[model samples]
Target: MLRITAGKLANALRGTVSGTSRVAAVRCLHGTEESAEEFDKRYEKYFSREGIDGWEIRKGMNDLLGMDLVPSPKIIEAGLRAARRVNDIALAIRWLEGCKDKCGDHQATLYPFLLEKISPTLKELGVPTIEELGYDKPELALKSVYDL
Candidate 1:
């Protein structure tokens, strides 16, 4: 009969693998610590390829927003523009909502700024404009867009 305890097996496996491999340190940037140039590089590296559509943009933004990181207004604007290019404004709005919920004032401030930037495009798409919705607050404006 062979009897091997879990501890003995773990110790044997540990001995077989070397712990000398260097593990890269992960640095997380928040607030203004991350620069616009760095954000541009990341966006270009991931989504600047030809034939990249809304699905890819949404997926990429989802991954970026999933991280415990806060992006600058320029980065968020770039993401919105990418979404608009693929006619995924709804998804972009949802992403901004999620960011507003998670990041509070910083994202809240950006929501309206982005809405203004995209309002003309949204009107062209037959979606209700922010002014037409009679909502000055970004949160309400977003809700109106969702309802459409």
Candidate 2:
């Protein structure tokens, strides 16, 4: 799990720095940096009733990305590769799909690199032509080609 600092969360959410001051105080009182699980629990307790927007969640993830608290790109790539190598084509496809969802325009640039690694396995999967995959239309293609 990713551990994020309260200040980082505040900055990412564009919330008042003082919003996380209480959380920071709690951490200090506990004599240890709070773990992500603790922060998530507090977030639910403090914010679940407040009706926060999806943008806030996006911001928090962005902050985590900026702080390198989220999984590294190399780690993600390696996992994708491993999934393909292990003949877990569904897992590899989901991994790439997630990359496209999270990275957006940047995904196009990254896709070629990932494709170089997994295209053969993808072909073996017998669904989702490369063209469909590149266009982010894997499901339709998969259903048509593989009847799945």
Candidate 3:
């Protein structure tokens, strides 16, 4: 019995098998290091582009929020503006939550700053803040866990 992979089969057919899987993973696009400001600007531009759709808005917000540092206010404003333009109020709210989550322990300070910075845009775009949406205090579990 013998086992040969598709790569080997292809190589044999082509008269050579340099081999596959064992090849060292090459790092693509090691061009330059991106700064936090540049990263923020990139995402801001993505959301601020005219005629951006819901899917692109979600993807851009998600990818930006998934990064380590919290998104800057300008970026969040752009995303919120885009979300409203795309008529996605839910996505706009979700992005607010994502930004809050990314704030970690500094949420006490930074979150308010973020809200303040984006409040005008949110209002202009007719998007509600998490508090205005009543999501600032979730009451799904009324009593303490010990009550359960």
Candidate 4:
């Protein structure tokens, strides 16, 4: 298996790869010809710095491809907290949206928390629930409800 740096993996996710070349490289290094032990060693080396970000992407890909492994709740919670800290409402919404599939047990718990934060603004705009407004068109929804 070919060893890859965490920074290289992160950069690839951020569009640094530009095309199929990086995929080809990774495949050549760790694909069918590589043994499971070699792949595990190479992956561990990359996971050191990429950390949760790397794991999250791996989980997402698994979900997309219908693989069975799920991400840990801790990672989801940390992502939600980070989104909240940054005041990134859309990101927070997406985090919650994505969690719906993997964290069904905690979905009810998150609703009240989200409602508490956005309720006032939602009410002021006469929107009853987040489901009533198109997240992509929040401004338009607010304007329609409030005649703004």
Candidate 5:
């Protein structure tokens, strides 16, 4: 369950190894032929002050979707955390929407917990709950896979 991107993993390894060594380690560990220069550039951007933002998380999720990979709860959670860290409610809800749409019934088990995590932010922003967003049922707000 290596849920994070290679660049993130590489950046984490930087505490133990130099950046160049980390890049080499990642390359060797993953058996990737990507050039050191490319990895360096990618990691530099990835480890910047902003780190990985919600947009990048969305793009990564989209890339996985484009590859026909169904997102697991961990993937969805990562995107949600990124969206929340960036204070992007629209992106948070977009990830929620993706969970509903792409994850089907499997998403139900996570909704209550996810809602608990995001509810404060929603409240702070004065955003309406899914029920107020035109959903007819409370359970549907947590468990429904279809958009309201």
Candidate 6:
């Protein structure tokens, strides 16, 4: 049996790997990074479009929340409004939770800022936050049998 350290393997393959990565990197860079404001506007426009259905709303939210960065308050506001227009109260609430989670370590500041900015829309749309509805904890979180 033969075992090669990753360092030795990389040194052996570096020439080919580096050559391939350069072309791949150039192709990847074809898409430019959008500004935060542009990002917010793009998503806001997506959710505010006419005839947007519940499935589309959920898909858009999934894509936005799945991004590396948390969405802006305006984008969230627009999404919640779309969910309300589609008559999906649960989706609205869940997106709120999703935004909160995306706050990452900045929750102390970012989440509250989001709530404050989006509160008026929340009230207008009749959507209560997950915390306000007291559902952050699992309803069936019982003690494990082994714990006894």
- On TM-score, the leading prediction is 3
Runs with alpha carbons beyond 4 Å of true place in candidate 1: 1-36, 105-148
lDDT of 5 by residue, 1-148 (tens): 4756877887887666766664455456556667645544443344232677666766765654443324444455455556666778677666566645554475566655656665665666555556557542554446557754
Lowest-lDDT window of 10 residues in candidate 3?
21-30
Runs of candidate 3 exceeding 4 Å displacement: 1-30, 145-148
Candidate 4 residue-wise lDDT, 11-97, digit = tens: 778786545664445446535656545544443343333334534544443442232223333343444444444445565455545
What is candidate 1's lDDT per residue for 37-85, written digit by digit as tens? 7755776566655678887887877866765556555555556667667
Model 6 TM-score relative to the real fold: 0.72
lDDT of 4 at 136: 29
> Which 10 consecutive positions of candidate 5 have the poorest summed lDDT?
40-49
lDDT, ranked from best to worst: 6, 3, 1, 5, 2, 4
lDDT-best of 1 and 2: 1
Number of the candidate with higher TM-score, 2 or 5: 5
TM-score of each: 0.48, 0.32, 0.73, 0.28, 0.40, 0.72
* Each model's lDDT: 0.60, 0.50, 0.78, 0.47, 0.57, 0.85
Model 4 C-alpha RMSD vs. true structure (Å) is: 13.7
Of 3 and 6, the candidate ahead on TM-score is 3
Backbone clashes in model 1, listed as residue pairs: none
Per-candidate clashes come to 0, 0, 0, 0, 0, 0
RMSD of 2: 14.9
Model 4, residue pairs in steric clash? none
Q: Give me the runs in candidate 4 sitting further than 4 Å from their true place.
A: 1-68, 103-148
Sequence-dependent TM-score of model 4:
0.28
Least accurate 10 contiguous residues by lDDT in model 1 = 20-29
The candidate that achieves the highest lDDT relative to the unseen native structure: 6
